[model samples]
Target: MTKNILFIMFDQLRFDYLSCAGHPHLHTPNIDRIAERGVRFTRAYVQSPVCGASRMSTYTGRYASTHGAQYNGFPLRVGEMTLGDHLRPLGMDCWLIGKTHMRVDAEGMERLGLSPDSVIGARQAECGFDVWCRDDGLWAEGPDGFYDENRSPYNEYLKSRGYPGENPWADFANAAVEGGDIASGWFMTNANKPANIAEEDSETPWLTGEAIKFIEQAKGPWCAHLSYIKPHWPYIVPAPYHDMFGPNHVPAAVRHDSERDNPHPVYAAFMNNRIGRAFSREEVRQKVIPAYMGLIKQCDDQMGRLFDFLERNGRMQDTMIVITSDHGDYLGDHWLGEKDLFHEPSVKVPLIIYEPSPDADATRGTTCDALVESIDLPATFIEVAGGKVPDHIVEGRSLLPFLHGKTPENWRDYAISEYDYSTSPMAAELDVAPRDARLFMVTDQRWKFIHAEGGFRPMLFDLVSDPNEFDDLGDSADHADIIALMYDRLGKWGRRMSQRVTVSDEQINAARTGGKQVGILIGVFEPDEVPPAASSKYRGPVPTKEKD
Candidate 1:
């Protein structure tokens, strides 16, 4: 039987929001079901804390710094090998049904004389996936124009269903009906109100239906990336989901007053930003967390629908279903509104993989605490599709060994996450040069160390003693040893050979001994110094020089 992959990703989903992850109130049975059938990675982290960079890492199986799509709107440069680029040759047809948040490297493409209309260029423009239905899901209209200028199928679908306005994605799906005017979900004040659209017509359900449609029509083994842009922003859900949870269900924000008393300069800047100050208010959390919970609940329901369709069609037995998120929402955690930090709430994401092969049965319902990164997904997909992971291009190790109930040799000791705040408002407030406005997080089992650029001292947290991460031991002389160790790890990761993609390690090793066979020998002092076979060609060519 042919093996397939169902790569499902949710935008801005937190690690602790699901019931399986020990959420006291928000239950996610559908997401939990996948965890029960396979291994749930408790220590999975994104390569970056923001959406575009994190998703780029997952698609390319490389670090954001390596791929050069450091932040949102930064293009995934041409020649960067992504999931489809690796898996297609192994007979797996990779397709995208939703958001990748991938921007094309227009300059790179133009330099190479590649047209976006061509097959290769089109695949490169869409993050290496053959586009099934592409939508980045941010249809917000600004004073200039819509945030995403791409033609929106979701908006068209809403209009076809009898919804009014040119952009129903914003008006109905993301706006709440007030007494006379529609309150935009862009404003946190409208978060408590129900979205004007029907639950079935909402983004999650619509994407889920599209995924089912793609699976029903696929002819052969394929990797369907069903990425949902939900539980993200415009934190308002339709009807039943909107009222399912209230402020009472919201957990206390994991923050301490001590964090504000003399925080790291970089942390202080983020805390004092407009979004952070707004979310820092108690009333804002009360209004937003319930709506956030509702969005996740709606997502879980859609997962059930998608899973049921797969099982009824016998796709479950052959398909490996992976459920995860791009990054996570801060949502008032640590006095932050969005995901642009190294906090656990902003960096850690839920990762569940349900592989139906009998080889995975031994590890069913088990939770692995291995330090997993988002880049590992593409590597895993390539390996599952019967392709060898090219270590020169793909920087992550495959998780198949862990799925088969065995630990891989030389497993990673640390997980890394990066954030480029060069274009952020926080950078402007801090008066930092674009090059210096960077942050990198290197976390192992016990220590989570954050190294900020611009000569700022590193932020250190003792996860063993202070898992909440309220204390900043960055200036403490006592933990300097641990800080030094983490710095060394970060330096080692930075010096990795990430750019030698044109050749593989195997090719390099073979080439070392291959030169002599082709009759090209360097540094041979004498005929006696080499074997007869190597010097035979030269021995016969020796001739006496003409007298001058």
Candidate 2:
């Protein structure tokens, strides 16, 4: 039986970047070890391609549309339940060790009269987690001021370690010390230089130490969401990891000249995005990819340290480990920069789950090619805790069967992803209304379809024929039937009963049974068509006319 859960998430990690997943140069043996011990999902995708919304979906086991945190920095409306909410009922405590990228639902809290400092209020404010440490990790200060509202604990730690600056997170932690000058990590050119901070003091290692400390002191059943903020942006690594890779180690961009020729309107808009434009240059990629690889390598090394700690403490036998990412960076794929589009590189992520039980031993070092989603983690955790998965609450099916080495029948055929660009500058440039600035993606094994709101034509790619997703078959009349079928699937998904939280399932079921006893026939056609008990009330209806 699994006594604990260690849910780990890496920020902006690509699906094919790991050694086990066949990256030519960037090897991640520590992560691959988890895959070796359990099952690796090859086709797992996130609910969204952006950080905030994607993490919200993963935490809540629901789509971005259902959670209503559809974009970065968007609040996950109060009263929305998360993994913490689901597991707490089962006597499992959920604690945060690192970043959640959660923006509190302040407006909802205000309306409900919840104090931000109170215990329950704080849990609600911090996405239902009891905070061991909460840091969004981006403590950047510009001329306009700090990019975030909350104080970064990582920055405070750097300050305590004797790094001097108003923003040491940038000056030392992310910057390269070059002959008394601080080279900002945000510049791609500075990626080759090592960060000023010591390797042990780097973000990944510090967070790993914090998590180990938490586990050592923690009692009873608990889950530590060890979220790492690295390989995301400000691409710079500390010490040995900084010197690990070079320009030759970076792979060629997955873009082509055909993508630039008469692209779809929304696609073209993304291709022309500022980040996309910058990454399109080969020089920028060569300089930055090495740093990104270094950060990942450091993360993997920290994982080795973390695993060693668990083994030393004898906790490895009881903990169920899940390794995944919130979303993938475009990294110049498909003529894009960040993760916003529905291409495989942006939305698909590496998912590895290791259930520490004899039952899962049969599937060790195996790969599962089922279509999995980031939302499935909540249900998986709940099940691992030996609790009943509340079907009405969690939108995803549990992966317990898979973990037990059983292939489930009648699984979902398609994986879905959504993106809301209303708050993006692209909406302003394209003159799209916030309400209409949305896109939905539906994909099976062979075909991928993208449906944009506001009268925009759908984008379709036959993934079998065009694996790179460079060609747009939306304009081709030959694929019209396929496009219509995909739209139908999207429509079916949209029509699901979402945000229906007013009544419990038991109450709804009770109404069905209780109504029949009171001579009420739901969906009754003719008077005689009702049940015999219900017919009693209708047969005596003539008495009402006599009274009148």
Candidate 3:
């Protein structure tokens, strides 16, 4: 049977927030339902904690170092092969229904003479997906202009429905009405108040409706990426949902006073940053956490709607449904508000994949603790669409074998995450060079090591001893052996074949011995030293040098 893929991604959703993941307050029955029918990966991490870099990794099936789109506004280069590039060859149509957080490499495209109007160029510009509807959903307007320069369809929709403002995305959808004054949701104080818009017009529900419309009209054998941009920032929800949770329901922040005592310079810089300082306050957490929970609850309800639509249309039987997030929100965890650190709240995300084929029956509803990366999704989609994963380009291994209740040989022992902070204020505050303002996290089952570029020492967390990551062992002399071992692993990963994308392993192996057939043999001392078949052409064509 021809397979279809429904890839659903939520923005800033934590791995532990769902009811299935043991969250005590938030009940996500729809998301839990997906987990019940599929395998929930407990240890899945994104290649980067931030949205754009993580999404780029997910789309290209490569790490941030490989793809070179290492931050929010960084562009995925024009020639990088993405999920659509891989699956489209096998007669699978790849499409985007909502946000990709993908910035087009206009400079690279211009150098290559690729027009965004052309089919291939359009795909390349859109991170390889054919655009059904594209919205990055950050419509915040500053003094200069809107955060996203792209035209806002969401704003237009809000206007058409009589939302009274030039930017209803900020006015009605993201702001609260306080005594006839518009209280911007950008501030955490307004987070407890209901947004001025109706619930149906909120970003999550609107995006869900867009997804259902796309699936309803789409042809079979397709991969539709439904990426939502809510539960991210502007942490305010519409009425009813806004009051769903309060300060009482908010979990205690996962942090300690000891974490701030003589912290690593890099970590300290992040902690002292504006966002971190704000979230470090108890009042901010009390105001923001409840609204954040409400946004997720709204998303779960939309999931129920979308799933019910799929069931009614019989799309569930043929579609491989995947539910995951770009990355988790820090949400005051480790005294951080955003996802720019290597902590579990910032890097680890929820990953649930339901393969509709009976081959996946053996592993249904199981939980896998294997160290999985976000890059694995594209590899999984390529395999599901009946295409061989091009290992030279796609760095991630297919998860199909795991879904079929088999462990693939030589499975990865660790997961990697990268953060490029050159463009961030933290870099400037620390006086770091642009090239040196970077952090790499390599985490296994026992330890999580963070290697910061420049002259700073590495940060170490003994996950076995302190799973909550309260203690730092980077400065401890007793753990020198373990730190050295982790450094060796990081060096080995740095030497990976990230740029050898033009040739496959098979091609390299075939070319190794086939060179002699074209009379390019090297290191041959005598005719007898080489194979007879290889020396045949040289034997017949002996040319004597003319006296000169």
Candidate 4:
């Protein structure tokens, strides 16, 4: 009999939202159980924090550098190998049940049985999923079949219940000119909460039900890709869960009082922008985070149903249930919200692997602080399924070694990640004198660097000392060696990206351990940096932390 592997991902699920992660007030018991059963990775990262980009990297296991699907509008290239592709050929019956946000264009529309008219206000290609059940893009759909005009999700959801209005996202974006809700961050806050909690909401229950079904119908070695879009936005959960958490228990918002502090200007600008700026502690308490955690707990409660079904169907022992989020939600950790910033709160996500077998070590609740990524997930799954993960197809090495209790001595010194600053909405907001976009990053741990474009607006954070990521070592001559080394390493690593070179993990590791020195400042194991402004008082959890 083939093993049934359930790959579950929560949309915009932050790394620390899980109950097992020591979240004092979170409501995630089901996920907590999953952690208890298997391995929970502490420092798992996504390639890009944005949904489309992160999903693309996850689906393809290829870095954004080669994928070129750097942002939402950027389409994933055709003919790329995905987790689905690898499994399907092995007769795994891979099914994409919900939220395959892969931007299906006309050429790819037929497979999923979708048409141009199928989507109302958003562009949805039909063939994106093998068994699709999704609304318009990123919950940005209008009341397509439900109403007359384009309305906010709040309005469209209300329309399904006999209410109607313009799309809030659109409305809020245009509100400055329209003058309806000026300075009011209602769209992300109160307005969207009701729908989130409603059992009638299409996406949530649809996803949950399908997950239950997959657990029940597992006959053989099957792979079900269940993606949930909740805990992502609309900060709404149904009634009981909606009122699940009290405001007083929400964590405090963070602030950095360092003069040396200078983040990527993209984030700094958002901090100083009208709606942007580090959120206040009171804001994190009142209107900001409670709802986000509410949704987290909501996902937990729903996932509990899946767990119950697995045990009921007697499939618990034969299944390798993996739970992870595409990315992390920065719930005011550094004053950021749902993602795209190069802060720990945005990029890091909780990666919990639960393989229900008695033979699995009793001390299964282990956390690997070594930097890993979403791109490594597919290979690990393939390895666990006892299937052949083609050499060229898999990008990251298998976690089977770590999972199987083989503590390989001297794992790679670092896990490298790079993000091009020019791709975000925040970047266009600034029109610098000389138009130059610089590529930079934080290493396996700390010791950050930014290689400022004109060499004037630069940034560097000694993240070890300043976990807040506020201190900018950019202009300091004291850390000159670190700065120059980071820039040099950035050039080498950045060259592989911009230049498109495919080096094996062995080769990369060779460069790391074999002392075959290649590039600039190579980072060992450094701690992560905290983002700025994740929770806003007026906004739900959109701390307005802009990513570069």
Against the true structure, what is each candidate's TM-score? 0.97, 0.93, 0.96, 0.75
Model 2 clash count equals 0
Indicate the TM-score of model 3. Answer: 0.96
lDDT per residue (tens digit) for residues 1-548 in model 3: 78899999999999999999999999999988888888999999999999999999999999998999999999999899998899989999999988998999999999999999999899988999998889899998889987899888888888888887788999899999989999999999999999999999999888888888888788878999999998999999999999999888989999999999999999998888899999999999999999999999999999999999989999889998899999898888899898889999989999999888889888889999999999998889988999899999999999999898999999998889999999998899899999999999999999999999999999999998899999999989999998998898899999999899998999889887764366767899999998898878777756888999
Winning model by TM-score:
1
TM-score of 2: 0.93
Instruction: Return the TM-score for candidate 1, rounded to 2 decimals.
Output: 0.97
Q: Give me the candidate number with maximum lDDT.
A: 1
- lDDT string for model 1 (50-130, tens) is 999999999999998898899999989898889999989999999999999998899999999999999998998999999
lDDT by residue (180-298, candidate 4, tens digit) is 43332234445223342245444455567756765565556777778887777655455555566776767665555543155556566556543344343355336656667766776
Residue 273 accuracy (lDDT) in model 3:
88
How does model 3 fare in lDDT? 0.91
Q: How close is candidate 4 to the true structure, as a TM-score?
A: 0.75
Which scores higher on TM-score, 3 or 4?
A: 3
Which lDDT values do the candidates have, in the order given?
0.92, 0.89, 0.91, 0.61
Off by over 4 Å in 4: 105-129, 135-137, 141-186, 189-193, 200-202, 259-264, 278-281, 357-359, 408-410, 420-425, 432-439, 446-458, 495-548
Q: Where's the lowest-lDDT run of ten residues in candidate 2?
A: 539-548
- For lDDT, candidate 1 versus 4, the one ahead is 1
Question: If both were scored by TM-score, which would come out higher, candidate 1 or candidate 4?
Answer: 1
